[model samples]
Target: MPRPPARPRLTILDVARDAGVSKTSVSRYFGPERSLLSESMRTRIEASISRLGFYPDRIASSLRGRRTGLIGMLVADMRNPFTVAMIHGAEQACRARGYSLVVCNTDSDDLLEQRHLDVLQGYNVEGLVVNTRGHSVAPLVARFEAGLPMVMVDRHLPGLACDMVGLDNAQAMHLAMTHLAEQGYRKVLMVTPPIPGISSREERTACFESEALLSGLESELFEVDLDNEPARLGERLAGWLDEAPACRGAILTGNGVVNLAVCQALHQLMPAPLERTGLLGIDELEWCALVGPGISTVEQPVGAMGEEAIIRLLTRIEGDAEAPVHRTFEATLNVRGSTARVD
Candidate 1:
């Protein structure tokens, strides 16, 4: 059978032939000079390429090509609504700039993050915006050292040295704590998500603790693993409710869903939840109003962060800046019925 004639190595020439266009036209159609083609012709070429699964030879193209005009976004957790919002923001900005975005979810794993980075790099993405979960920054440092364009989104490493775009987590947590303190809640308990040396969470939690200490307010920490048994979080909170102080206490939860778990546990543990304890949720909850007492929350400007990340990446890719640029936006504390003044 002659191995099916070696399967006729599919190339741009074959794609152009199948699409009824010159190979050079197809090449130019997919090139950085996209404005040279009409919308209809560009759409046709894209459709043809999609149908043929024709991947351009980046290695050979790189020798002579100017740019891939692509950007990669790496999210540590796609399920988190905040991350989703940020990505949506990035997608909008990327499209507006005539650059396509390739998104990868690492699920908060270093190995997975590294693998995605390698694959994206291999595909010759023009730049990267990453929300990393790992502490081992050697690989990323190597890439940045080799002059690959990169920007950190929502996560920071101490010495890895890269541009960062993130919410001001410390200031955000401090704002939440101050809100509770201002409401005259003597005892406050912060419900935190799992801290595995992830920069954002650690900074926010540390700031909350230190702020509470500085304010001379009584506070304690409780951690729940968000990756595992997210639903079972209610059960853990129920146990805390049983042992917590009876005197009017305010609880500050780290994430939106975690706030629901706390609310659920509060409902089960107390005949009247609000009278027993106050709640101030971190990150806005969709069902905050639907639930009784309407949870208060700190809303991170997730979309803004995403927009900033992509903008910084694009600027780097376009040779606007060679040095790292870091931007931190403060979170807004939205007061609600769940945690009111004690007067």
Candidate 2:
């Protein structure tokens, strides 16, 4: 005689029924706010859940739910290799903890960033790791203040406080500037993104300027919007080079994107019998070391930064968002042929 069909596998409701408690009580028992039930009741519910092999329907619960194991990452520009590497780090961390990541690109637009953030909230992501473009982040900050977890990477927002992981911008510049000076470069040009609002660029510019002044070396700044017109960089660089003819010196750039512009400018503006100009850049690029004169650089620990951002974001997700922490990895000054000593 065949045994009666096995009873349907137990679920949360079955566990609740066996434990003689409401489903809500069983949920409260397993959740953080565990004061709603007695120890005896909690134990009974736990035993029933274990014995019955019952698992909470996390997805459905998140639909009307509390704490979905999902995270949202907002990047200002997805094209940047540094940002892409950071995303890789975040993905590794998230996967390890059985969480999922949703990435959105805001293209440095405040409105787009806000819209993407709103969509994340609608999906009930447990946390957010953001690389905002310094737009209106007050609402996001307010949510963070009201207990939603957030961690910022790469760029810092003005007047908004959040846990952040990034490189020490000033230190990177100081190292690059000192390296250039040691190579006997008296006049230096710094190619950079727009300053004032862009924190990373601003910090780099400030440090370069201050260090140059301190060392009594004449330094010039050439700013460009690489994203808007990458090819137009040549024109801007040419103008800068034409104006500063005395500086047959090296050029230091803030990032890879700006470095491209600097190189293009050099290629276009230099008169026949091209002057041997030096080049240094922050944030290493794939082709940087391969080019002629091989770009000298202050290499940021991109992998480490990515890992740290995820680690910090997860920590905050686990109820540690209140205590603000800032971790900045030092940049390594890599001397290549670009900044070679002039005979």
Candidate 3:
């Protein structure tokens, strides 16, 4: 078979000629050393590039010691609404700052987390955003020691002086306990998923205990497997209702996932349950309002935390040399009939 001749790869010069502009202008449009070019000029260059189907030679540029304009993000799980909102916020920030984002989802798997970190570093990513469980994060520790510009979401790595941006768990716990106490909830039962290597979960648990004692409320916490008998949670809730007087007990959930699990478990009890016991959650769900009497919650600023993490990473990448920082976003409390005391 005869081989056809190959088409030459399009160059920036071709784009410049097509747009009736200089090669330097086209270069400026593509480079990380951003300069303010007129909007009309930018529009013309964009149209010409689109029409010619031009793709820049990023490999060649990187070889010449130029910035790649690439940032990497590591997410523990994509199914959670928190991860989704954070990713969306980061994508928006990257676009606004004229950079590209590469997201890696590890699903809380240690091996996959290591592999993704290696791959992100191999591509010479300018900075990283980590939201992993910190189980098998030794590779991450090495990178941090090597002085990579990085930020951890919701927590700092174990004993590593790293920057972190997340919801204020302590503040949230205080708020939740206070609200529940105000509603005459003398006892609280918080049900959560497995908690071990994740610092955020641990911190919330501690805060819940301390806040309960401080607020003069008795509290009980249960750790359960979501995959196994979810109905067990309902049994626990039933016990709570039986132990405390009517309108004197409440259920406080760990996060959105736990909130849903507890809701499903409590559903079988039906009619009297919602009105009898108070209910509140840490992470706000979109369906909270649609539920019966609406579920109360302490809503974390997911999007803001994501945006701030990127902002902090960018600062480090731009050579801001200072001690590690901790940025915590506030959570808002949404009160509903679910928390109202029946006199």
How many clashes (backbone N, Cα, C below 3 Å) per candidate?
0, 1, 0
- lDDT: which candidate is best? 3
Positional deviation of 180 in candidate 3, in angstroms? 1.0
Better of 1 and 2 by TM-score: 1
RMSD of 1: 4.3
C-alpha TM-scores of all predictions: 0.79, 0.78, 0.93
Flag the better candidate by TM-score, 1 or 3: 3
Residue-wise C-alpha lDDT for candidate 1, range 208-281, written one tens digit per residue: 88988876678888888765766666765666565444555788888776787777777866677776678888
Cα-based lDDT at residue 71, candidate 1:
86
lDDT for each residue of candidate 3 in 145-191, tens digit (9 for 90 to 100): 89788899987777667799988899999999999988878889888
Best of the candidates, TM-score: 3
**Candidate 2 minimal-lDDT segment of 10 residues:** 267-276
lDDT comparison, 1 vs 3, better candidate: 3
Prediction 1 global C-alpha lDDT: 0.79
Stretches of candidate 1 off by over 4 Å are 1-64, 228-236, 242-245, 268-272
Model 3: per-residue Cα lDDT at residue 328: 93
Ranked candidates (lDDT, high to low): 3, 1, 2
Query: Which residue pairs show backbone clashes in model 1?
Result: none
Runs of candidate 3 exceeding 4 Å displacement: 31-35, 228-231, 244-247
